[model samples]
Target: MSNTVFCRKYQKELEALPFPPLPGKQGQEIQATVSKPAWEAWQALQTRLINEKHLNMLDPESRAYLMEQMQRFLDNQETDQAEGYVPPTQA
Candidate 1:
């Protein structure tokens, strides 16, 4: 079966898996594998989110809500990274 089909059929099994089954070599090796420009772009998005969208600016309840969403996004991004979901280069 195609990877898509296989993954779909076993969606639950795939739910929390690291796609490549191996984490990238950590530390410096990880940096070496990442393109400088791509890393810069990801850094920019991270900056925007924390500087403009973080909970510190919100009222307590709204801050809690935004914090929850942001935490989920961060958690998902971590999962995707572990699963080898490289983002496309910015145009």
Candidate 2:
């Protein structure tokens, strides 16, 4: 059977990731609280943030910013948005 966690993002119990998605205490926290779907959603947003903001992972500041955003995202808290980002208009 798969592991289940009380996903903070979804506010419900759901399937957990097979392993920690990141390193350190934060990763352990996430592994115990975040679900796979929520993690995947964060991954997509992280990619967009990197691309839209031209963030360099090699820079400590950039990594820190992303980590802060990821924590907020998983906690269902408000997060910073990329400048000039506009949602696509519905067809």
Candidate 3:
């Protein structure tokens, strides 16, 4: 059976991630609170930010920035967005 979590982002019980996305306590916290859909959306936003902002993964500062953004996103707070990204139109 799929795991379920009280999603911090959606504020409702929803499908949970199968595993922690990272190591250590932070990862465990995410698994306990963040849902699968929220994490997937964060993945897309992170990819866009990396590309649009030309973030250097090797740089400690770049990693730190992404971590901050991830926290904000998961908590339903405003987050830094990629430049020139347009949301898709609904049909």
Q: Which one wins on lDDT?
A: 3
For each candidate in turn, the TM-score is: 0.31, 0.86, 0.93
Clashing pairs in 3: none
Colliding residue pairs in candidate 2: none
- lDDT tens readout by residue for model 1, 1-91: 2122112212222222213222554333323333333334444554554455443554787446544543344333431122333558999
Q: Give lDDT: candidate 3, residue 80.
A: 94
What's the CA error at residue 65 for candidate 2, in Å?
0.4
Residue 87, candidate 2: C-alpha displacement in angstroms: 6.5
* Model 2, span 1-91: residue lDDT tens: 8989999999999999899987998788889999999999999889889999999999999999999999899888998877787778999
True-vs-predicted CA distance for residue 67, candidate 2, Å: 0.6
Global local distance difference test of model 2: 0.92
**Per-model CA lDDT versus the true structure:** 0.38, 0.92, 0.96
lDDT (Cα) of model 3: 0.96
Candidate 1, residue 66: how far the Cα is off, in Å: 14
For model 2, what is the alpha-carbon lDDT of residue 30?
Answer: 87
Per-candidate count of clashing residue pairs (backbone under 3 Å): 0, 0, 0
List candidate 1 stretches off by more than 4 Å.
Answer: 1-25, 55-91
On the 0 to 100 scale, the lDDT of residue 50 in model 2 is 99
